[model samples]
Target: MSVLSATDVRRNWSQFNDDIVREGPQFVKRNRDEWVAMSTEQLKAAFSNFTFHAHLVQEDDGTITATLDQFDLVENGSSEKEVLEALTYELIEYSQEYMENFKLYFHSPNRKAHFPYILNVVAQDHPENVRQLITCQAGVK
Candidate 1:
């Protein structure tokens, strides 16, 4: 769904883990020893094959809300880090709808030409059918 931080996985271990208990299979190093999180299916699908972008906002009361640029999805949390973690599930749950935006993106010549290189592509470009994309989240609130 979305890339997660090693801190995100550490802070919420259970949420990052699952029945498939293979180490490092669901993570990619960000820098040093820090890692970015992903689902098994996401891994097989090649997380790097697609680009996904997000927008984070700090609300009036200090809560943070993260929204995917490609989707009409919003996730709230106490911090930017937390919002990012929550974005993992927000993406999967709203995947189908989010993908619809691609249709629009490709339809408009200007939009398609100006599409950011950071947005994730749909399964068509990916071609690999990820059978199990586990939904995960954390205590971002």
Candidate 2:
């Protein structure tokens, strides 16, 4: 609940950073804008509950297809591993695009709910880390 002015934070950047590391997060207000500063670890923990759930199906041709339940994305490959890799790649790209146009995507009604999931994806340092967050289940289709 403690909010510091932007000037104070700028003047004590080192202390501000140290405080965030020790206290978890720090809030700063500048003009009409308010921002929270926290470590990447904190960000990851905040969205850890968010996950990507996918439905998997084996195609008639023997390929495996995965469709994400949370996002409008699908991928197919020769094996489950390959399909998961492809889907994860697509998710990463989508998350990055969503962030690049945050205002547009965040304001949309349907996409608003995607914020936490996008944050979870962004919190990951690598594609493999993101991949581990996804859970897959077999689908009839």
lDDT of 1 by residue, 1-141 (tens): 345566666677785676224444455345566454545455435544445556666778989877655445688888865666666655554454435677875676655542322133233233222112222232233
In terms of lDDT, which candidate is strongest?
2
The lDDT, on a scale of 0 to 1, for candidate 1 is 0.51
Best candidate (score: TM-score): 2
Q: In order, what lDDT does every prediction score? A: 0.51, 0.94
State residue 75's C-alpha deviation in candidate 1, in Å. 1.1
Encode model 2's per-residue lDDT on 1-141: one tens digit a residue: 889999999999999999988888999999999999999899999999899899999999999889999689999998889999999999999999999999999999989999999999999999999999899898634
* Candidate 1 TM-score versus the reference: 0.37
Clashing pairs in 1: 51-119, 51-120
Each prediction's TM-score versus the true structure: 0.37, 0.94
Worst lDDT run of 10 residues, candidate 2, spans 132-141
Off by over 4 Å in 1: 1-47, 96-141
